[model samples]
Target: MSLIMRPATEADIDRLVDVYFSAFKENPINIRVFPESSPQSRAFWKKNLEGDLKEDYVRFQVMETVDEPKTIAAFAVWNAPQKATNPMPPMPPLSAWPSDGEVDVAAEFFYDIERQHKRFMGPLEGAPEGSQQRPHWYLELIATHRDFQGRGAAGALLRYGEQQADAAGVPCYLDATPDGRPVYTSKGHGFREVESRLYQGGAYEHVFMIRDPRTSA
Candidate 1:
């Protein structure tokens, strides 16, 4: 199926939210963190998604069939590196979670993500060894509608960010779920596993991977 990529807009929020929830409906971490899907929970996602769209450093893109009545097949959220002088705002606070959501688990998960992000993506200048201190792109989120899996939609979305990072002579970063690790680390992709962590007492796990810029022939 032919697909086209485009920047997501505020008008797409309703469909985007539905696609996001549908794509991760069975994800272990999401299942644990957001066991129930309420209007409040959806509201939180909508608000944060809007905030992401407005951020200069954030790139939110959606993929759709090229045919008429284009149907959104997948979406990805990327965070472009910013200068230290103007740091991006932190992730939404725990209080921002819905009343029925697993606040503690969600908080812990986000905390770990932030810690690893800051540690691995350090200053872009005069940095230390073994640190990717460069202006890189971070894959904050990527998902495809269940019915759309295996159609290359997700890979296309990922490659869009990879292309941007390559043009800037920087790397790309992402935390992959077990099911996604193989694809991300596969040859041609070149994402190396840098760290792995388990949450909910091993019920859920994510592997952090980094891909250096690829030079054109």
Candidate 2:
């Protein structure tokens, strides 16, 4: 079955929420941060994604099957290095997240990652939407629908992000889960693990990786 990658639109949000929950249903971070297993959980995810979509530097991309009435097989949320002409607004503090979403656990996990992000990439600067010292494309989130995991849809999205980073002569970065580290490091992906850190107060961990831009000889 053929798969295609393209920019996701508002119309795709509902389906994307489905893809997200279906894909990450078993993930540790997903479980810890989004503990609600009810309809309210789905609603929270949808609202969160909707907010992310409205941000200037955030880009939502999807990979879908080629058959008619195509299914969204996988999706990625990327944070492009901000341009001065279109700077990103500050994000709300984790404290502001709804209690139903397990905001405390999410804050613990995300704050841990933010510590690594700042140490390795430098703090984010508002002037142009990039790190103070090292600018790079950040993969904020990615998920493959359970039915399509083995079919390479996620790889296509990774390659698509890599192409964009290569075009801009910048590195691509991500925090890879235990289940995702292998794929990120597989041949052709070029990601090298730079650090491993525990999150959720040692309940789980994620690996930070970077793939430097390919240069012509």
Candidate 3:
């Protein structure tokens, strides 16, 4: 089936959230961190996706099968450069999630995971003082619908970011799940692993990788 990619809007939030959750529902680390599958998880994902769609620096895109144009096959959340604003914000508090006790606990558990991620990625997040740093595109999240896993939708989204970053002469960065690292490293993409860490007390590992601009000279 043919696929088309386009920017996702607020109107697409519900479907996009479904794509996100369904795509990651069986992911080992995701299950380990948020297993209860409560409404709180749904609400948290909705709020986060909405915030991303509203952010000027974020490029939210969805892939749809041309055969069924309304069906979202995959989606990507990318962070590009924006002037006059701080793109990085503090992690949302657990209180921001739904008030149910289970949801609150799930939110807290994921927050802990976020903290661990920061600890592993801190050095890459900034550069040494007095050194110039080139802005790079960040691949925050990318997932294919469970039914569309092998159809190349996710790679298309990654290539979209790569094309933009190449044109602008910037690198690309992502924290890849074990299932995704192979795709990111294949097809001459040239992503190199810089760090790897186990999450949820060694249940799963996330690999941080980077792809330098092919247009760099």
Candidate 4:
């Protein structure tokens, strides 16, 4: 099987969103946040992906199998340091959402998650201090399509980001789910857990990890 990794473009948004939705549809955090499998959930995710693709500070990449290049096997989204006058823009307005009611419900769920995160992390300390003080690469999302889980596509995408981070002389940061912790801690990435927090009323816990830039020997 031939596999390729490349930067994602606007034309790839739908496939990228599909990969993300399929990978996270059953995730504990996504289930807790979205709750329902509806057009609204799909639309929200699609729009979010679109917005990410349009942002100058964001980078989106996808992995595809050569036999079916149009089908995304995995994807990763990241945020680079932004210029002082060009901070990351806000999410699309409510009117752009698919359904007002669904958006409201999702907003409340996200708020709860944020509140829990803040409570566990403490004010202004959710991320590592070094990352806050310096320009760093932030991994916003990474997922492998369910059918492609065992094939190492996720690791490939992660290493791509690490190479970029190393080239920039900056650390890389990501929030990991329970199932993803092992992968992030494995040899190549050198990620260390900086914080952990339980959510969903104690049903789950998320891990925050960072990989410091490699120093020349």
Candidate 5:
């Protein structure tokens, strides 16, 4: 099916919420990590992203088949040059910590902190060796419906985001959950060990990740 890609609008909020939940339904780390976050982690993310648009820090996008305007198969949330204005827990420590056993503990608390660090000091979040500048844009969220995982839908979304970032002559940044890390890597996103954390719901473990297209080929 051909997808009509466009910037999300207010009318699209509900569907975007559904798409946001559906795409991130299984990713708990993405759900947590926000300071002063709520029990309804999913709800928090939905409201936070949509609500934060006021700060001009958010840019929403959707991929929909021509047949269903109410149904969104994929979505991307981008953050302009601004701080992550949401309630979130403190960032966990890196390497110095141990694992929580074979159950795949959430080893990404430090990841969240790293993201916060980026919020505080863009391009200096984890400050690469001799790194002096921060990327121009950031990706708050990105996902595709499970049914369309392997499709080029995600790349299409990223391309849209890239165009936005490229227009500003800056690189794009983001935090990838566990599953997203590899995907981002394949797309040339570098994976750094930030903080690891245990999400309350399923106790899902997640790692913090960053992506910069500038340094990538």
Candidate 6:
């Protein structure tokens, strides 16, 4: 089936949410490894995506079925330079967050992977929430619907983001998952062989990878 890529609109968020949740459902490693399961993770991401989409700082792209308007294939986005973004809810005692989707879904995500791999996913550094302005593009999220896996939707989304970066004359960067590292490397993104890493829960290591769209664009 043919797919069309375009700027994601508010009308597409529901489908985007469905695609994301479906992808996560299809990847149990992501579920058991992540901290957002138990019924509320879906709602958590929905809140994040919706709030981010409403922000001028966040940009998103989605691929949809050309033949079936009801279907969404995948979506990718960059976010930062936000204005007073959502704050993390208070955490429970004696926990970085929670193994469950309690204080923060994102942190739960970190816990999921950290607990699974026994390594940090990336450097534990970020500008204070909404306080730092990102000069380049950040790949905040990307997901291909499980139904559409092996169909090149991820590559399409990557190319689309790079095109945007090229048009803006900026580079694109992302904190790559172990599963995503080879994929991004195949597309010419390079890892910061140095400090762009994390040491979480002890030995878990998450590395960062970036693409200079100026070259590949």
| TM-score preference between candidates 2 and 6, better one | 2
The reply for model 3, stretches above 4 Å from the true place, is 35-37, 83-87, 97-134
Model 5 Cα lDDT, one tens digit per residue, 1-217: 6777887766766566566656765554443332222334445445555664555556777887777544677888776554333322233333322222211233444454455645533444565555534545666668787766676778787777676665666666655566666666664434344554555554565555444445334
Output the better candidate (3/6) by TM-score. 3
Any runs in candidate 6 off by more than 4 Å, and if so which? 26-39, 80-134, 187-205, 215-217
Provide the overall lDDT of each model, using Cα atoms, as 2-decimal numbers. Answer: 0.83, 0.78, 0.74, 0.72, 0.57, 0.60
How do the candidates rank by lDDT, highest first?
1, 2, 3, 4, 6, 5
Whole-model lDDT, model 4: 0.72
Q: Tens digit of lDDT per residue, candidate 3, span 41-104?
A: 6777888999998888788999987884468899999988443133343567756755543454
> Candidate 2: deviation at residue 106, Å?
1.4
TM-score of 5: 0.62
* Pick by TM-score: 1 or 6, better one: 1
Worst 10 residues of 4 by lDDT: 116-125
Lowest summed-lDDT stretch of 10 residues in model 2?
Answer: 83-92
The TM-score that candidate 2 achieves is 0.85
Query: lDDT score of model 6?
Result: 0.60
TM-score of 4: 0.79
Better of 2 and 5 by lDDT: 2
The model with the greater lDDT, 2 or 6, is 2
For each candidate, give its TM-score against the true structure.
Answer: 0.92, 0.85, 0.81, 0.79, 0.62, 0.67
Best by lDDT: 1
RMSD of model 2, in Å? 3.4
Question: Looking at model 5, which ten-residue stretch has the lowest summed lDDT?
Answer: 95-104
